[model samples]
Target: MSFSSVPFFITFAENPELAICAEDSIKGARLVLKPFKNNLLALFNVDFVQGLFGLATSGNQLVIGAEDITLGAPLALQLLQPESGKLQRWDIFSAPGNIVSAADSCLAFGYRLRTKPPLQLTELNAPPFPQWIFLPFTTTQRGILESAV
Candidate 1:
């Protein structure tokens, strides 16, 4: 399965910002994401699961079930735009209700964020990305992903 650069949702009203990233909860990390302005959550590719919250530059699109975990957090997030890339980032932090995923797409767990990201995230180690593959919405996609178990 693949996903497009455009997120499932978009944030146009607030021109969002990156509030925090509580990357210290997930296990077997397979996905990364950021929050935006219009209740949009941006998912990204993660190379590996380093620790509770370790960062990587090489990875694949985050897949649910494959990651094998659930989101465990109430995140305070904002949107971020890198200087040279099409992929957007959501700078998020854990809140009181945050749940970490041992292995699952952040979106599959459940949360709300915006799309209009702030510019502070460019200073981080975010690499350049021209495009991404968003999984198609179909029964086949669901069956294939579900069968991974």
Candidate 2:
């Protein structure tokens, strides 16, 4: 299957030779670890109840964000170690629209209530105890967050 430029597709951090992908459809989502080179040999695939829309690597663990198939249902973030077949899932409490990794942490982000700001960022590295971060948006212009080394 062809890969998209979205978070659903990513390269395995530990081994660049292998590609990490999540295919989402009406039938549900499937997470796969395979080589993107000459041939295709899937290392492992784990199915989810919803569409897996996010993929990231935090430390030695792989983080997957799943879409809420039903309205008002809490979203999920799955932590996986493909080589050992170890996997764990955590709920997001809120409906998250996307996921990304930064500062060595897996972050689930989306808009919350219409009354609140248009963005909500949550850290999932702690698992079960996600720290919520709110960025104050005053104007229509977006603020740029820069990290200085």
Candidate 3:
């Protein structure tokens, strides 16, 4: 999938050589992985049951996260080893909007105000390596200074 197509996530900090994108096809959601720095490699696509909403990488392990509005908190997350063909699964309590790798084997992410902490990224021990996810912040509070003549 093209960058302009659907939502795209890459491991820029952890592994600049690899990247991933969520491809929505006529059938269902697909995970597309390939080399970002080199174009000689072919695109690797895998069929995913849940919608891949977020992507983060730690070392060679790729942490895949999904969002389910129907199921309040997230139940689990997937860890895929591309070369080894091994996938690890873990459970989480809450849901996270966007997930990024944090220091000390932690994942940090922001969730809506009403949502509870989904073991999502709150766990202290998770992922072998992590990537950085960044989003712009905004404040709603406004102040106007009044001038006295």
Best by lDDT: 2
Q: Give lDDT for model 1.
A: 0.24
Worst 10 residues of 2 by lDDT: 132-141
Writing each residue's lDDT as its tens digit, candidate 1 over 1-149 gives 22332222211222223212223223323233433222112323322222121121112222222111222333222122122111222212322122223222132123233422211112121232111222212312233223233
Residue 60 of model 3 has an lDDT of 17
Highest TM-score: which candidate?
3
Q: Report the Cα lDDT for candidate 2.
A: 0.31
**What overall lDDT goes with each candidate model?**
0.24, 0.31, 0.29
Error of 2 at 92 (Å): 18
The better-scoring model by lDDT among 2 and 3 is: 2
**Estimated TM-score for each candidate:** 0.20, 0.25, 0.27
Model 3: residues with Cα > 4 Å off, grouped in runs: 1-9, 23-27, 37-125, 133-149
- Per-residue CA lDDT of model 3 for 1-149, tens digit only, reads 11112223333244544444333221223334334332211122222222222232222123344332222233233444333122222222222322432221233332222344322343332343233322111111122112323
By summed lDDT, the worst window of 10 consecutive residues in model 1 runs over: 50-59
Supply the TM-score for candidate 2. 0.25
lDDT of 2 by residue, 1-149 (tens): 11122222233434554443333221223444444432212212223322222232222133443333222223233454343122233332333422333221254433333423222334543333323221111211232222223
Of 1 and 2, the candidate ahead on TM-score is: 2
